[model samples]
Target: MKKLFLTLFLLSGLLVTASCNNDNKKDKKETETVEKETVEVKEEKVVKTPTIVGVAAANENFTTLVAAVKAAGLVETLNGDGPFTVFAPVNDAFAKLPEGTVDGLLKPESKETLTAVLTYHVVSGKFMAADVVKAISDGGGTFTITTVQGGTLTASLDGDSVILTDAKGGKSKVILTDVSASNGVIHAIDTVVMP
Candidate 1:
């Protein structure tokens, strides 16, 4: 009777230990699943969209424009809470200007002129490509946009592309449009539009 009781006790203890081990495995799996979900949520939250200035600064194609904006002291202004619409000119667009023109504009004494030039590229409100096209269609195939610098830019269509005619009667074609930013939008042009 003693031997039988001891054997029974040992078997019960082993069974209980085996059951606890199984429960531990289940708990571990649950913990691992929760941790995996937490990590996934964290990864999703890490992606952040930059502002207009930040976007331009991050892009290699906008290096010249970014440098000009910085030289003009418009970085802080552009980064403000404005829904500005910018007709951003790329590096090649800046190259289209006469030689030494960009260097001359970057001078400290040229801050006023540079500011004017930069501001001319920006409109006060956000105007997406669709809105611009619709406005052009409504205004007898041409839309006049008033710039932040108090200049006017004429918008018209040419083979489905938006063409901007600046104050100097120079033309720049919009190569890309609807680049979203935190405070504004950027429409890339093929040539620099002057005020």
Candidate 2:
């Protein structure tokens, strides 16, 4: 009788231990499944929608503006963490310039001029068209914006549209308004005015 009682107790203990082990395995599996789900969510975020510097980068019209940005060694900077707003000018806009002027400026010797012109079109922080329009309507007299080049661009409201008059009195009309990008905004201009 004593031997039988010992055997029963041993068997019960073994069964309990085996059951606990199985429960632990189930718990581990559940945790692993949750971990895998979390990993999948993170992987989804890793797929980035590539944003060109601004709408200008995507715009077929702003070929001149794109070329100038490339020439000024500003592609990376514009692509960097800017909430920049660009007054992007098109190829036809550049053609409106004085004869031989665009070509002269594109040369390596005229980098300073090219850089100034390019940066003049940019506002350092992102400004949505609505905000800019509102600002223009307000009594600020001058809505001053700092450029990527550390200079200021002044905006004034003329009738319905915003008139951006650079430091040198060069003016551009905002044709395409409020194009948003990951880094900035782009406003298409009809003419490539100089600064």
Predicted structure with the largest TM-score when compared to the true one: 1
Please provide, for model 2 over 1-195, each residue's C-alpha lDDT reduced to its tens digit, 9 standing for 90 to 100.
999999999999999999999999999999999999999988885545344465566667877777888887888878888777788887888988899988888889888889988887777778888888777668466577777667776778777777777767787777778777878778888777555
**TM-score quality measure for candidate 1:** 0.83
Off by over 4 Å in 1: 1-10, 36-45
Please give the clash total of every predicted structure, in order.
Answer: 0, 1
- Please, what is the TM-score per model? 0.83, 0.70
Tens-digit per-residue lDDT, 108-154, candidate 1: 99999999999999998899999999999999999999999999999
What lDDT does each candidate get? 0.95, 0.78
Residue 76 accuracy (lDDT) in model 2: 88
TM-score of 2: 0.70
Off by over 4 Å in 2: 1-49, 52-54, 140-142
Model 1 accuracy (lDDT, Cα) = 0.95
Evaluate residue 1 in candidate 2 and report its C-alpha lDDT on the 0 to 100 scale: 100
